[model samples]
Target: MENKNRLLLYVHFNRNNQLSEHVLYQLQQLRHNFEEIYLISNSKLTDGDFVRLTDSKLADGFLQRENVGYDFAAWAEAMKHYGFDKLANYDSVTIMNDTCFGPVYDFSKTIEQMESDNQIDFWGITNNRSHKVKPWEDKEAIVLTDHIQSYFVSYKQKVVQSTTFQKFWSGIEILDDVVAVIIKYETAMTKYFEDAGFKSAVLFDTRKEDWTGMVVHDFSVFNLPELLRRKIPLLKIKAFSYGAEYLTTPLVVEQLKASTLYPIRLLIDHMTDVDYPDRAYMLGEKTLTFNHENTSNNLLKIAIHLHANHLEPIPEYFEYFNKYVQDYELYITTDSQEKKAAIEQTYPVSQLKSVILTESDEILSWWDVATKMEQYDLVGHFCTQRNEDKNWLFEEVQQREIKQVLLKPAQEIFQTFKEDSKLGLLVTDVPTFYQQFKTENLTADEIWGNMAQIWQKIEFRKDRDLKRLSNKSLKYATMVWYRPQALYNLLKIDIKKLAIDSGVLIDEFFPAFERLLIYVSWTSGYDFRVSPSLPKERLVLEQSDNQVPQVLGVDFEQIRLRKLLKELLRKVKKIITYRFKLKK
Candidate 1:
């Protein structure tokens, strides 16, 4: 049996006193390796809270107090409680904190590798050596003070028993200033150990000559083979946050895909969902997987309608579909014969079929081009979706959303439609976040009204098949895929009537088409489906013949207005509370 005396001191600091999923996973990894684990959290957690951790064998016990000294202070408090001298009786002392993610691959692998290197008196999973100007000092300091990153560090029995180690903890003075505490405490630990004849080492040393003088290297491109050879298991969560700013989110994801971790896609999801707020759209990264079980028999045909300007993005999508998807047909539709000829030459001649349209108008081009190419099982429609008024950052985000969310899910989306015959129209239901929805400058109810009017006008034979024609509220999205027959009523609608009205503040015609398309599907004996379900209840028509369309025509406007009023009231409450706090 392993020595019970071997202690693992884990420092945790959560401002809310609530444990997050990532933090809990980190604790579970530590418990698997170390039997005697004591937690020191910088929160005034009650006995009931400790009961959960203790019951799960996540902690032997924990110390709760006001968060004053951060992780450094927590470690010192744990040492005092355990008894400074009594800690020397342990085989080793592993000091860790909830500062990162992982033991991503396996905790046992990291432990086995670290145990092999018995000569080292102390070691860390990673080391900090980035060059930065010291706040306390005037000169730029190479932040490497021969220190191991304190996030996860282990010390041998000899070092733990040493006078230098005991005195260092005993003499630590917790300071109010965070920078001072970090400099005097965190960075000082490794140096103090080395100075007292304890050999210090790291699993993944950043100061190694292989580094190309970058302030921060992208962790997504972290060499897993090299990490396995060197025995580095954990990834710093802050590395992705740094990558999101410095290296870009896409590159971070690209590098993560190459790692040895199981379910790399889920890891990327956690990065976008849990870690980086700016990269929430990257949750669609997993949609890139091709899960069409029987692609051999059914061929997925994709067509791209290109506008006059910036048809450059068309080739990339064509190439992506050709490269990744099997048994897929590619078609490009353009008004200009010259542009069509040029695009045909760029891709493999046999694979691509170009449909040159007589009409120059964007919607007319889609109608004529799709009809000319015979009928496809699935038809994908996309507008340029560019806002010349917005900055490049916004443009990049739009392109990513289009490419990652819309284009990547093609095969799976096609399969979803093929499996269900009743499912005619498929559109991605992007949640109306205030940050995004407010930018469009169009209310949901206003869009709803425009669609309702267009649907009523377009369906001339509504009385003939009144039972089939039921209204389902649709979200405004540019990218869509649907069965060709779904647009039977839509194909009959006169293009002249869709003329932009100058009286309206917004061009309601084109925007209304997005919603009207869903109505057309319903009238043509087909049901529309949204990828993610709606956030709130709206008009949704099920595939069942007996089921009635939801009562959204009149009630939707009132529902939207009430929601707006609630939001305004919340803003007003926040403003009043801020002013009240200012008076104090």
Candidate 2:
């Protein structure tokens, strides 16, 4: 059999305008089947990335254009650049995009299988069935037609040579709306070619399969595990981000690791560009103990910043640190000379770097010391003020939470950072005190309150999705173990000036700033993990009803019944009012 001359046009886009390792890996895998590969990037490449892409020699041709009209526009631009006559010379041309992760298995096998079929004019890795209403359409009454998913579609020589294909490419308008582009191109392209007498086939015929009760109509993302099991070449990138609600991304990640020789780091690097809520779940490693027997050899340049506003907890704090931490440069920030003297007395002045007196609150003090922190590789921040308002049990939980990161698992935490360069922040999991009142959405007002104006001062990454910031599992008391690089954006801000401009109280500023730290770390291209204070079973035991105390002369059981009766009466009143309004 004569080998066909295959060409691949791969569309690439990155918010940072840099080529990712995953794309390069995909191109490397695709080289087996395609004689020539062209990379079309919508995002203008950075000089470094441009050099990297060109130096790799993965693509025969490269096109960088204005990022408009999404992937379809990029494909159209590539087709126009090549000209129809030149494109027709190839036996087959495959148009694919960087929206997917793989070519997990060998691409040549899939290409061979598709090429063997003589009847099909064009083919795609997967296809969608005609549905009542399009996923994005609610009021438009649009019925999505059965079509080959545009992410990965290959056209035979006959289709490429045909006027219909040429006309379709020429007629594409650069639309601003994503849905408009999808309706005009992606969902319509297959039907347009078919109507012009091009017979289309798909590797996975989703029309015959039952997708009943599925979260989405796009099977590429929702049914990725099954597709991988059946030897599908690509995995949609959305599976890790928005698609997580419908499917378990960690399971799919594990499957890829076990089944294929694909580099998992490529996936992790790519995830930094998107809003992945499961960063902790996916990248976080629980540190039980330092793997090394001699932990002294691997000791990092550690800085422990203790905001000792209250002098009483100074002894307890130092005692905890003395017990677990082997070595660290201690920097204490105290408000009053009296408190500084007390802290100095509690911990030896020889061991301490300095006891700086600052009028600014905890967050401001941390920011003031940000310059000093940059010198250290790992920085741990804690405040004695966190224990002030809490009751005995709550205080104990808070202390344990802080100890989890800085004391009990201190060595393992250090080891985890040393081993994983990408691991930025290790925060204590939602403290038991806050767990009882956990809400999925913590409003900006609720979190920042009067200090909300501080957001304007902080320079956040433009590429980051600000919406995801609101939904993050926040570190309430802002106790954290982090790499200095993780808080680069936050640390760069002139926080003193910000406090002056915003007129937010120094005491209230820290809590508000704490809310934004997780987001800042994420935008800085770092991953964070939640370190649980205690084991799950132990936490359950601590949170049990037996731990609660009954107030003297107060009948809690009677009060509970009264609350239930009030709720029932309110519901009955609402029902009566609703029925009366309906009758009226």
Candidate closest to the true structure, highest lDDT: 2
The residue ranges of model 1 lying beyond 4 angstroms of the native Cα positions read: 1-5, 44-51, 130-132, 136-144, 216-231, 245-275, 278-281, 285-584
Cα-based lDDT for every prediction: 0.59, 0.73
- Estimate, for each residue in 78-130, the C-alpha lDDT of model 1 and write its tens digit: 88888867888887888888766666666675565665577788888776654
| Candidate 2 local distance difference test against the native | 0.73
Q: What TM-score does prediction 2 earn?
A: 0.75
Model 2: pairs clashing at backbone N, Cα or C within 3 Å: none
RMSD of each: 21.3, 8.1
Best by TM-score: 2
Give the per-residue lDDT of model 2 (tens digit) for 1-584. 24579989999988777778898888877776788899898988777776776787787888988889888888989999999999999999999999888888877767787788899889998888887664464555688799999999999999999999899999988999888888879999999999999899987888878777667767887777678878888888886676553325555776788899888778866775565533532433232323323245446898899887777677777776776666788999988888778777767755589888985467767876778889999998988764445365676666766675456667777887898887788777556665554423434455555334555655665645555324334455377889998897777877667667667545555655766676677777777766664452222111111122222234558877997999999999999999999999
Query: Per-prediction count of colliding residue pairs?
Result: 0, 0
Q: In candidate 2, how many Å is residue 22 off?
A: 2.4
